[model samples]
Target chain A: MEFLSYLISGISLGSVYAIIALGYTMVYGIAKMLNFAHGDVIMIGGYISFCAMSYLNFPGWLALILAMVVCTALGVVIEGLAYRPLREATSLAVLITAIGVSYFLQNSALLIWGATPKVFSPIVEGTQNIGGLSVSNISLLTMAACIVIMVVLTLFTSKTKMGKAMRACSEDKGAAQLMGINVNRTISTTFAIGSALAAVAGVLMCSAYPTLMPTTGSMPGIKAFTAAVFGGIGSIPGAFLGGILLGIIEALAKAYLSTQLSNSIVFAVLIIVLLVRPAGLLGKYVPEKV
Target chain B: MLKVNDINVYYGSIHAIKGVSFEVHQGEVVTLIGANGAGKSTILQTVSGLLRSKTGSVEFLGENLGNVAPHKIVAKGLAHVPEGRRVFLQMTVEENLEMGAFTRPGSEVDSGIADVYKRFPRLEERRRQIAGTLSGGEQQMLAMGRALMSKPQLLMLDEPSMGLAPLLVEQIFEIIKELHKAGTTILLVEQNAQMALSVADRGYVLETGKIVTTGTGAELLNDDAVKKAYLGA
Candidate 1:
């Protein structure tokens, strides 16, 4: 029973990581740029929802929508302002710029929201007894949200025109352009979707933990990024798989081994997995075709 | 029909194309034969809106293409098969075709893909297979088929025969001939001067970013200087 409880909470934690990982994977897949500022966007989302629900007396759903809107716009603006100009630059240069953007977001959040932490109210309160096991409603909701998001994202990319356009842009930007698909618009749409997902992740994460701060997104952000790489950086389904596995491993390690060594164990496992599959579990190792 | 008027293109500080002017008449096959770095690809890129000319204009269907975005140029009836067979390697053959018709209306895409499949049955056979696994000749065919999915009136092929075997090259040239018979106006850029000339109705010799000479395909094919420099005579 205790093990089951740990697994449930692990899955809940993994769900949040999956949500955050989707943003990283999508942007990396389409724009071929790592938006390290993505984690900071989660922080912004938390702050947005916090201000909305607490100060403005907005409902949970309304706060969620507001955060999504702001984050979506923020994503588009960031892509346009920071990453767009560096499209032709080297990957290392873009990665450095991404780090710069990350720092900018973190510092800006500090200036705006201050360094102090806010006690976050659980968006969904109380617990539910399902099949003789009691679980927090927020945890169940997080898991549900993750599954629904995964299905919706899969359908969106496979069935819709814009989704297919995004896939094409990821596959070959120049060829996609020649096919008369608007590559820039597709990338911008990717950013919007990714950041929107980030907002959902932010809300869920803060709700589960009930502590919100400007730096709250950083650690989870890094873990989710690791999950994305574990599953395959460019594959959506990969992110989900990676996140769940990472969360489970971290949970199990903390429970069975030593709590203080959990993060170290996680990183160590990652190194082993990567050594076996360099492209991650789902990523295709494409030859240098160019 | 397309008209390129005094187009001067630059690659940053380097003047890659200098005062290049040419035209592709309706249903005509025009070949631009040149050595490497002679700006053959640059001219095609300029016409397709990939690279903006430093000076001069490119008019397709009697309208200037200067302000048009690269992605929008195909909708204007000019499709460029860029240098290297840049098929979406990760995508399946059908998916690549689907992306090709991205600019077209949803209603027309099915028929467009059907028409392409009819033209290239090999693509139909490998519809579900990833493009990267395709043979070099097949990838070139897929690239051409992808370009054709845009319903282009003017097809600009850049190095379609590049890196293919001699037999595969002949097969590609045969397809080019077939496309010409089907009334697609072609602007073919090639390093394979001999094959380019044989299929071309007219040919232009590009040297160091300028058109050094121009003539009928047969005339250039038989010219003493062309024979000595390009034909290995």
Candidate 2:
């Protein structure tokens, strides 16, 4: 029973990580940008949703929509101001700018929301029993929602017109532009969608856990990022798989091993994975054209 | 249909294309032939708005193409199929073709795609296959086919024949001729001087970014200097 509980918890947490990892993977795939500010964006999403729920007294659905709208706007502005200028700059310059944006956004939140953690009341309450196992309704909801979102995102990317353009841009921006796809617009839209997904994850996570810290996103963001790399930074499904795998591994380690070395165990897994598959589990090795 | 006047393109401080000038009349196939590093691609890049010229003007169909983004250039009926046959490798051939008409309306774009499939029947067969999986010649065809999907008034091709089998090179050049016959203005840049000049109605010789020579294709092919320098006669 305890093992099943652990498994459920791991899967639930993994679903969140997977959602966040999609943002990291998608941005990296299309823009070849790290977008280190992604975690802070999630932090902002949680705070904004909390603000809408508490201060504006918005209904559940309305608050969720408002949170998404705010996060989308934030994404667009960041891309326009912080990212656009660095579009033609070297990868290093863009990455450093990402770090700068990350710090700036996080600190700005710190100033506005304060450093204390805020409790978020769950949209859905109570426990549910499934197959002789008890699960929190919030956790099950979070998992199901993430799975649906992932499926929709996957289909959108693989089957739609704009999605095709995005894939092209991911493969080669110059080539995409040559095909008459507006590269800049495509990039901006990518950031918007990726951040919006992260925002949804943020809201879902806070609802399930009931705590919204200004820095709540930092650790999870890093973990999601690591999952992105582990699955293959440029591969969409890879990010999902990597995130869930990491989540399950972490949960098992915490359950069976000493809590003191849980983090270390996770890092050790990463190191082993890296040593085995340098390009990542699903990453393809692209040869340089001389 | 395209006029480049005294254009100077600089990469940082290096004058890559210095004082380059040329014209491609409507419905004419104009070739810019040179050795490597001769700024052939640079001229194409500038005309297509991928690279902005430091000094001089590029007018396409009486409109100044100054500081316009590359994608916008396509909307204005100017399409550039960049060097290296830069097809979106991860996308399927159909997706690549769909992206070509990104600026067009949905119905018209679908019709345009149908037109491309008709033009390059091979592309239709490989529509479901990823572009990177295509053979070199097929990829080249997809590249040209993708540019055609933009319904371009003036199509700029950079090094279409690079890294192709000799037979494939012949096929690609033949397609260029056919495209010209279909009333698409072509500005072809090539290091394959011999083949380029043969098919071009008019040819310009670019040496280190400046137009050193310009004449009818046959005239340049027969020019003693061109023969000695480029033709290896």
Candidate 3:
């Protein structure tokens, strides 16, 4: 019974990581740059929703929408201002700039929201007992939301014209441009969608933990990055599978082994998997042809 | 329909194109034939807005294409089928063609795709197959079919025969001739001078970034200098 409960919660947490991982994988796939500020963007999303609900007196649903919209705009702005100029720069330079943006976002959140953690109310307030397993409504909702988002994203990428453009840009930016797809707009749209996903993850995470802090997204951000790398950084389904597997592993480790060793276990697994299959579970190895 | 006037282009410190100028009329197949590193592709890139010229201008259909974005250049009825047949490796042939018509209205996309499929039935057969797995000939067909999907007035092909079997090269050139007969103006950049000149209405021989000779396709094909320099005679 305890194992089942732990698995449930682990899946919920994994969904959060999956959502955030989608952002990292997508931006990296299309723009070929890591937006290290992605995790901080989650913090900003939480803060926006928190501010909307508590200070602005907005409804919960409205607050969520507001957070998504603002985060989408912020993502586009950040890409245009901080990353677009560095499109042709070396990977090292872009990586450093991303780290700088991450720190800048964290500090800005700290200055505005302060160091004290704020309590957040769960979006849904109840528990559901299914087949003798008592599951928090938030967990079920999180999993449901993640599944829905994944399905919709898959449809969007596979069916829509803009989605095809995004895939084309990822494959070859120069060729995409030659086809008359606006490369800049496609990149901005990618950032917008990624940041919007981060917002949802942030809100769900805060609802589950019932706490909001400037550093709240830091750990989850790193974990999600790990998830992305584990699942093939550019593959969407890979991100989903990697997040759930990592979450379940961490949960099982914490339950069976010492709590202090859970983090070490998770990283050890990552290292072993990388050594065995460097491309991650679902990543394809693409060789450069001369 | 296109005119390049004394355009000078540089790749950082290396001047790739030096005051080169040419024109492509509304219904003629114009060929730019040169040896490797002779700036044929550079001229195409500059006209397509992928690279900027240090001096001079490119006028397409009488509109000066200065500082215009690449996508906008395509919207204005200029499609560049880049070198290496740069088809999206992960995407299917149909999806690649769909991307070609990206600037067009949604209502026109289906017909555009159908048109490409009609032109290259091989693409229709492998519509759902990933582009990377296709043979070199099929990839080249897909690349050209993709460019045609945009319904451009002028199509610029950069080395369409690069790394293809001799038979496939002949077939590709036949398709190029067919496209020209169907009224799509062509700016062909090629190292296969014999085939390119055979199909082109006019020819420009570029040497070390300069247009050293210009004449009718037959005139250049028969010229002693061009024969000695490019034909391996």
DockQ of 3: 0.68
lDDT of 3 at A155: 86
For residues B110-154, what per-residue lDDT tens digits would candidate 2 score against the true structure?
Answer: 788789989899999999988778888898898898888888998
lDDT of each: 0.91, 0.87, 0.91
DockQ for all models, in order? 0.68, 0.62, 0.68
Instruction: Give the range of the ten consecutive residues with the poorest summed lDDT in model 1 chain A.
Output: A281-290
The candidates score, on chain A by TM-score, as follows 0.97, 0.96, 0.97
Q: Per-residue lDDT tens digits of candidate 3, residues A1-290?
A: 99998998889988998889888888888998888889989989999999998998888778889999999999999999989998889999999998998998889999998989999876677899999999888888889988888788878889999888999999999999999999999999999999999999998899899889888888898999998899888888888888888888888899889689998898898888889989899998653221
- State each model's C-alpha RMSD to the native: 1.5, 1.5, 1.3
lDDT, candidate 3, B101-162, per-residue tens: 98888889899888888888998999998888789899999999899888899999999999
For model 2, state the Cα shift of residue B10 in Å: 0.4
Docking class of 1: medium
| I-RMSD for candidate 1 | 1.9
**TM per prediction:** 0.97, 0.97, 0.98
